[model samples]
Target: MDNVSQITMFFLSGLNETNNHRFTLFFLTLLCYCVTLLVNISVIVTIIMDKNLHEPMYILLCTICMNGLYGTTGFYPKFLWDLLSPVHVISYSGCLVQALVMYSFACAELSILSVMAYDRYVAICRPLEYHSVMSKQRLIMLVCFSWITPFCINASNIFLTSRLKLCSQYLGRFFCVNWIIVKLACFPAQTTVNGIVADITVVIYTFHGIFIVLSYMYLIKTCANSIENRAKFMQTCVPHLTSLLTFLLTGLFSVLIMRFGSKDFPLTFKNFVSVECFVIPPLMNPLIYGFKLTRIRNRILVVLTFKTK
Candidate 1:
């Protein structure tokens, strides 16, 4: 195939593709995106404006909220447009930008979650030094890395892919994930595979793995220390455990799909997991925090009431 023939613009073959279904999906996703915005924004504003929530914990949550906002922004707008206009083809440049959006937010979220895990570990295991260890400078440094690491990889992948020859026109997925883009490219892929493996190793093998181990260690230490209020600390940890499980499982599958799985997996569990990365983490992080910590819930309620004022 000629270079011109090899490359073509992609349409996000929607999951629910019928005309009526498109309208329904547009409204539903619109509602979700709107609500997510209101909630995350409220939390961010509250944490910033209210002195009560100016602590490291709430600052960390603000970072988490920012990730959620960007993630959802990266995901739903195209689907919404496809619904409204029935014209779903994305340009080559658009697809490349979309991949960058995905990489940027995904990397930020993974790193932020790792930071949160460490935050909780320090709070639980080293309460005396929690403030010292997670000082404002340290927190700034952590969030700076969260934002930087993702785009660094994003730049590399986009730069390399720009030079490749594309052979497969069909990239067998609903959205524009990088691996699907690579699958359609008619280029030698050993370098791509190595890059994928290295990304996973940096995240899963190096950082996330360390966070999980430290979290479990913190849990054990907390349990030992909270002899009188064992139930309280355990109850506090229940939400974190749930959040950690959901985040890791969804993230792991996303990496797995890019690494080893076929595109057809999207017709099954993989699609659900892909959606989970955007839909679940944002909703769950706030909900878990609200449920476990009365302070955040009350703060959210105050923020909501203020909005409706």
Candidate 2:
């Protein structure tokens, strides 16, 4: 209780091993961050500016790119600053906010992807009724649901975490996370509610993953019988699947590390595992969509060419 009362900031130990390579890491990180911003923004701008690309599919892609920005913004700036700073610490309230941003960003991403799967399913399975099913009003509602539901869930988790009486101010990882904060609680019994909430959150997103897989399964079966649908599936569904796989694999790796990571492992390796989802997904999502989607790629090329002239 006294320890919790005295703690005002958390000391991050993740950067301790990287001091010698701070400048090198900083430049590389800055370049990655900039590229992430440029590519995602390019995709987003291309979608918004082109009236022809204003369908639900393109809008979903734009939502994903926006989410990539949201998730990375929660980490990279603070991480870049930490690379140069003498001490890596964050205020109590700041830590909670970061946890909220990061968890909500990740949760919202899966929610969006699930919504995309549903959109794809309806478009491919019932083409005649696509617009009637996925009307503008409905699209707005789905988008809002994707973002808001996750935010509310994570907010509840963070609220539960905030009530814990923490014993330690030292966070082993580079950033604040609800799980880590809960782990810092002095009494094991006090964290039961937090653990339960976390488990429920995981279950919700796991269902999201299952929904995506089931949607694709039905898609494959339907597309197999039609030449045109097969081509359409190849054109659109493949990119969404690729993005979903990349995001899921990276996210699962991070979650596994957090759950089962060993202290015996090198801090540098652990740090990399901890932050891979934040780094890789932000950089990869846009590149995957940009190169794979013909409309986006052609629009981007035209924009670049026009800008140069």
Candidate 3:
């Protein structure tokens, strides 16, 4: 009845808090889910049908769109199930697979952003070499690494977790968060929390630090050098800034709550931030690029007005 010993069922209570909130959340999540699918599908279709967007940036956009596709789907399925079925039960195997796939996409998306950063880095920092650097073969290699590496990491993490015996009380976290589900398994480790911290730190440094530095470094230099550079810089930089600010603000709130606030505040805000990550990114990416990018706007307008009559 404690933390350890063989446990089967785990209960999660995020999206099912109150009747009114639950109904509101259900519709909200459903609306977000629909928008997520539509926006991403629109991007994917544009990339496929339009020969002009068969370029590297759009290619990465398509890949990120795929990750959003998986992420939004992974979250709502359980929420919908819980909305209908009061039990909200997930089998051990089901939890593992869900966690694996969820993290796979999460890590892949992170990697895609980093690779996209590098793409931007090369494009701006070394404009002459951008073509040679991110050639089709190289793009293929980057894409391969993004998907393959994360799949292995999360797959092993989930596999290790599956071996442990946990009580049925936890029922899995409200979401298919890999670390939470793994912790519930009660696998004996020297430092599970420290391991997660180290892993996240490494990820942040790898993707955010390097890119942010390189991005702004190139960004700064370009701005300083010429007025002609300003327009193109403004175009690409906006998406990065939008995503960056959104990510930083959400993460900042979570960190402040965890570090400075009381126990209740931390949990309350942490859950909010988790939803921000899950729901916001998919929605934001579309808005950021769709409105800002002229090509996407033109393509969208074209697609919307076409009747094939």
Highest TM-score against the true fold, candidate: 2
Question: Which digits, one per residue and each the tens of the lDDT, describe model 1 over residues 82-157?
Answer: 6787556787777878777877777777777777777777777778898899999999998888778777877677
Instruction: Give the poorly placed runs of model 3, Cα more than 4 Å off.
Output: 1-8, 185-208, 251-261, 266-270
| Residue runs of model 2 more than 4 Å from their true location after superposition | 1-6
Please state the error at residue 28 of candidate 2 in Å.
0.4
lDDT of 3: 0.68
User: Which is better, 1 or 2, measured by TM-score?
Assistant: 2
For residues 154-231, write the lDDT of model 2, one tens digit per residue: 999988887778889999888998888888888889888888888999999999999999999999999999999999
Cα deviation in Å at residue 190, candidate 1? Answer: 7.2
lDDT-based ranking: 2, 1, 3
- For candidate 2, what is the TM-score? 0.97
What C-alpha lDDT do the candidate models reach, one value each? 0.71, 0.90, 0.68
| TM-score, model 3 to reference | 0.85
- Scanning candidate 2 in windows of ten residues, the lowest lDDT window is 1-10
